[model samples]
Target: MPAVKVRKEEAERAKRLLKRLGLYDGRRRPKREGEWVLLPAVGGDAIGTLGYEVLPLELPLRPERQLYKNLESILAERLSEDELKHLRRYDVIGDVAVIQIPPELEHRVDDIVWGLRRVHPFLRVIARKGFHEGKFRIRDYSIIWGEERLNTVHRENGVEIAVDLSKAFFNPRMKGERYRLAQLVKDGERVLIPFAGVLPYALVIARYRRVKITAVELNRDAYELGLENVRRNERKLRGEIEFIHGDAFKVLPELPGHDRVISPTPRGVDALALTLPKAERWLHYYDFVHEDEIAAFRRRITEECRRLGRECEVRVKKVSDFKPHVFKVCADVKLG
Candidate 1:
């Protein structure tokens, strides 16, 4: 394997360029040696022309789950093209694999289970996922195979989080988004996070940045799990966390302003008017919006900022797809 050696500051830019030219190796994890980062790349004629030193070194492969299409590859021979199109992506939390079996593929549940088990040989449970229910947003899950429990210790972004699908909410797909936010956060900044389920965002940020984070959650189970998670990663974290079990609507009003306010707002709940006022510098507000309404969403946030008498700049980024033509977006609001 050929790897390029570039300064840490230029690593991201080089990786992007390599990816654009189809030379970056997505399967291998980059290794950092002090000021330089070793980026894995495919052997090519262009490798020597990239200016950076290219060395033949074996880099460690990323986790199998991050590859994302292994299960689909295993099932390609077992299922037809029409059935394959209905195959949705699944999440592997710790040792449990949770997937939604659509009506079209419900008859092939056994094959799906076999594929998942083959892909993740250490998997202890394979669950059929259901819609999120109640105010806590905990999903309804049925253990179709292996262990009869929904509890597992999920590891992501350098932290361990204990989650119980029957009790609380956790999304493993947000790992990259969480890391992006963590990198944006500065050391010593006072941060506030509302609807902090199991403290995923807080833990990841604190693991890298030395800051004081105050996270609030309304659900008792989530709050308890979040406290446990803090203890689980206390030694690894560089910052401090103060977890409060309370409703953000009532609690944030009594609290003082922070350098940054992150509202992982629940679906259908409008916390813009509630959270934007508490941010002294930056506000990362998450919401679901139709593609057509993204401009309207930006206007709404701008209007709220104006109403609050704060001069603001709002940049909306599509985080993920929620449904057809609908996306989960984050409005990064910077205030003066």
Candidate 2:
């Protein structure tokens, strides 16, 4: 297909107008040559509407480059050396870029937003204002640039997940964790996810393994999104995924036994102890703890199983960092 070639400086404005007219093709990246950007257009009509010259060139589809490389260069003149050093990396969830602005560089957030948008023309950048809180475990975010909406469809491991940042919890950082859990699941095995936010873990596992999964969520909004996500990914799924919208503690006990269980809730390990089915199963439990406290965390899971008269072997591994001292750890426990 032909694309509209416009000056690099005017590409953002042209993209906005093209998107508004429903002529933007997201599947192809804009081809750049010298000072001009070649945007994928539905037809030559977009050239007149966007006021750009037509380029009858076929650009090879390529994966997007990292956003930070361009952002760092763009903000070089606007940010001080000390402030630039404090910039943390951001996450791209579909077309939304969720960033955390450090206190030192907070005043230059507008410049940062502009830099992000300039680098990734299609992305809507937002600044994360608060930490993940409450039972729903969702963070507060404010629009820094681009669109005002919080809802977006994020694709991960060949599955599509529809989530609203204001209503539910969806972590793009957990892509590796979801993939790791899916790889561990065996064929024909039954799996359970007690903290299945928007069915990311369940959907990823279903796409890769032929297993039956029962996902439970406490938050009503997240539960509703999970159902929608499951329906959206139905054509690509390889197994059955059932969603239960209620507290894991209450909903888990009534459910049947499963070969594997995943508890990724941020509410702590108490929920795991309360809802674990009284049968032999593999438990993938997540928690936040310091490196030195990993042993104690493992002992806590062991004690929980001991109290229930179920012999178990527990191992803990660092999944990611929660802060400078704290870490997001996973305790893999096998109960018999």
Candidate 3:
């Protein structure tokens, strides 16, 4: 096995950097020798790219630890060590625990749910069947324990959002990104969030800034929930947020222009030209790209702006990784 050796003091920072670069291998524990920490790498090529010393060593395979406490304790007797490694990670939305059960462990779902409930008594467990599909970007989930409902109120950065997991798409991992975006909003500016699922972006921004926000959603259920969320946090908000229930492309052209536009949908950047109120507007566009394709992705955006006859100054930021070698990225475009 190949590993990167770093000073013990720099180990934690190096770990985060490697993970962000999609080069960290979590299956093996790091070895410590004197002042150096040996971190496992996914491949040999990462050493040159990361500027680290690569050390080849013989190490034994260890059982990957489970995030949920009782899952390992309960399944230890019933399943082999290899079977336990399949349980990677799960997401928690309010009182609900959303997990993806591997196809090989389909028959043991009942036991898995039981163990999860034992760890978090108040949590309602749901199993995600597959990747988010269709135009709506919603995933299929089956209730495995506790409540049968999918509706829950999630609190993020002093904002409360009512979301139906089956009807709308909301990623709790984006809490930091939402807060950062809200902080960038100037007072008394107009903002727009297209594909505003359950109004998470709108609510968070409105709670912090005095800007007026227009949120557009196509799904009827998500639109209704967005309305409820607006009322739920009306007293705490410092700004006005209007919930519009219609296709973003159809509704954007009809609404007034905004100083800043947030196209939160990864696939919605092309529609931004239609929503621009005038030249010199700030555009925050989200998209997914391969680790090695960021430069090409920005080039595409630059070409799109040229095709639309809008001059753009663009900057790219990596928000998070969706899977191995694939990242969720944001392009901050200043169009004039």
Candidate 4:
């Protein structure tokens, strides 16, 4: 086997270049020496041109099961390359694995289920999901395999959140976003969260910062689950959470201003006018917008700040892709 010897710091960059040039060997694992890394690669003219010393080193082959990281790879033998293009990314929530099977892959449900099970041996349920519907934003789901339940205690960012997909809305994809918000929060700051679903943002923030967070949710089921999540993570939390069960429109008016406000606004609901005024210092507002309308969206927020007589700096960050040319954005508004 041929391996390229490069410094440890340059190993990753070199490996990427090798992979991009179609010279990197995937079956073998890289070896680390004292100050150098031996990257596994196949023989090619470009390998020598990569400016690394090539030597005959016997690299260990990767374990058969550790070769592929995604479900598509495991199902490559079963699904055609054309059919595989329609496969969507799946999410694993606690013991349940949720996937969306397109119309093209309908006939291969059993194979898909088998692939999921093969990839995740500990999954208790496999569910086929539909679009979010109604006011609660709960997705339509049907159990396709294993246990028949959507209720699970999902653990993220050092907090345990009890979620019922049938009742309350919970998006595991927002785990990174929740962690990002948690990192931005400071201790002793008074934080407010409206449209707080299952207290995911609240619980994650409270887990890290020693601050007081008032979270309001309109969904009774989500509020109840949020209460349970607070209790479940009570001992682990470093901060305090006051969960309110009511419409934010009615509840926020009765409450005082806070140091910071986070509005994980529901899709199609514009709460900027409702939540922005309640923030004394900063507001993290989330919404969906078209790619071309991003500048317009920022201008709208800036105008809203001006109308409220607050000097603010608004920066819009694209959080995730909602659809083609559409993105889920977060406007981090800093009030002066």
Candidate 5:
């Protein structure tokens, strides 16, 4: 049928089934351009569907030569089993597979890597590791990495955030974020970043908004590195970002409420899924939606916020296609 008709049907179906159905990774996109499908449950507990151009592309589970098949499988199974939900897609080009995942799945980070190792020595579950390293890196933040590593080449406000896998955890494309954050915050806001993986989000916010950030991280090593990065680049970026060396879940209770809170841990969303240290304010959008389906996605979140009596807005900060159909979003959630 036509794309317009299919979208109308998909929208209607999604509206009625919100309780049973959830959005796909917003990744796994372009299933079959302009076609909407109501799919069966992948494992159990989660109902996935594609609409007006998105469909699932399932490839043969090729473990050999599939670089991260073990890791992907382990993560896919674990996330689906634990949350009974997660967005996953595997691209099988010959014997190799590249699986793109949301940032919210970073906590079980170690398990992801270990699982990959268990699968086969050749299959590598990768991590961007660190954005920066060396004399600038504090003792606790120093990471031990193999001679060779993967890196995410990102640029923000002119300073390129190139990952040095031997050291950092994330190297994000912050263009969308820099703008999205600007839309949500104001001057003098007390922004809190719990589990501040790399401090990019917090710093980005302060630089854009004349705000104060109290960044917290439980990982001693990560905390120190975050602290150093903030200081090292302080001159470059405007505003102050204080790194708190402790768990945000525990830390939040002791501290007073703030003007705003930022949870930069890539694997952040759905408060219930996170058991460690949570900073409460996440479990909302971190993806910046621009045009296209922005209105639809934003409307969904807005409606949910209203149902719970919470006041919020949809701020689209970035828009980039991760893969062919998978897109990454980083939007800010505010409570008034």
Candidate 6:
């Protein structure tokens, strides 16, 4: 076995070198033949996805132009461990760490999966999560993420939820609403939740008080997943929970009036301009769209209210800004 000797200076240089190459705290470093150390891949940031992201395999030598080419060969050669069709990489948290590969790379995810598990077989393979910004890392205490740990949780409010870190799926940042609903909901509020993904919000509300929840979801897969989650944790629920596989726009009119409704959606919210013109009920929107777009969206709601002759009370809350970019911002939105 050959020992890849590193002088004190060289090791320090390697740390900086790899850091620039998108390798961080948890990257495997070969000290000698067949011996590697998986360091702590961790960091912290107030705004961003899960704080820390894993550092996967790296090249033997720096081949910046040939990175993809090297990774391609590594995949075709079956260099990875367990097959994972869902794993992906990103430079979301760190600009240099971010790299975009085509969806076809899904076939190659196996290489990465196999590669990581061989070195750290016990770690859970959380797939398809995005990357960290410069200040953020998966190891960061505040971020609270890792494949080994489940992102979602059963809130004290009794809602069993799968945390959608991407915000494309769910935003855990909507912590304030938990308090708002607790105060507003009465003994038996008939509540409607459109586009319910896992019904995390509804579950929390149900835990706080007795309520009849009619949740509408559009995607078949998501709706089914939500049902399973609801069933698994039914004991935690205090009220009747119903799941409907229907489009909100198509079904909103058919359903009877309710005391309250929740519309928590859009990871990088654009605006509700499309729905504003026909807005009927008071709405709460919590998603990241453009700041400028909210006004136009409100106007649309005003027009819709006028036509229907309904009192449309609306509220928009900026849940959190997930990331900052040169021309755009990803944020959480709530419309009421």
Question: Of the candidates shown, which would achieve the greatest lDDT relative to the real structure?
Answer: 1
lDDT of each: 0.93, 0.81, 0.79, 0.90, 0.48, 0.48
| Candidate 5, residue 14: how far the Cα is off, in Å | 23
Question: Which candidate has the highest TM-score of all?
Answer: 1
TM-score of 3: 0.77
Regions of model 6 farther than 4 Å from truth: 1-123, 126-128, 131-158, 162-168, 175-179, 266-281, 322-336
In model 1, the clashing pairs are none
Candidate 5 Cα errors over 4 Å, as ranges:
1-155, 158-164, 272-284, 287-309, 313-327, 331-334
Q: What is the C-alpha lDDT profile of model 3 across 161-189, one tens digit per residue?
A: 88888888888878989999999899999
Candidate 2 weakest ten by summed lDDT: 58-67
Per-residue alpha-carbon lDDT of candidate 4 for residues 1-336, written as tens digits (9 for 90 to 100)? 689999999998998889768788976899999999999999757777867899987688764324233577889989999998888878888898888999999999999999999888989999999999987899999999988799998988888989999999999878889999999999999999999989999999999999999999989999999999999999999999999999998999899999999999999998999999999989999999998999999999999999999999998877887999899999999999
lDDT score for candidate 6 against the true structure: 0.48
Error of 1 at 288 (Å): 0.0
Candidates, ranked, TM-score? 1, 4, 2, 3, 6, 5
Give the Å shift of residue 172 in candidate 6.
Answer: 3.2
Give TM per candidate: 0.82, 0.77, 0.77, 0.81, 0.44, 0.48
Q: What are the per-residue Cα lDDT tens digits for candidate 2 across 244-279? A: 888877778788778888888665546766555523
How would you encode candidate 6's per-residue C-alpha lDDT over 139-208 as one tens digit per residue?
A: 2212212444334443434465643333314434344566576566676777777767656677777767
For candidate 5, what is the TM-score? 0.44
C-alpha lDDT of residue 240 in model 4: 97
In candidate 5, what are the lDDT values of residues 1-336, reduced to their tens digit? Answer: 111113534654653444234332322222323455432223322332333332344423323324344445666656656531443433221112233444665565455545544554543223322223342231122222232333333346544343433344553444455557656677766666666666767766766777777877766655665766676567766567878887666776677656665555343243312311222343334543334776676677666666667676655443555445445665455544
Count the clashes in each prediction: 0, 0, 0, 0, 28, 40
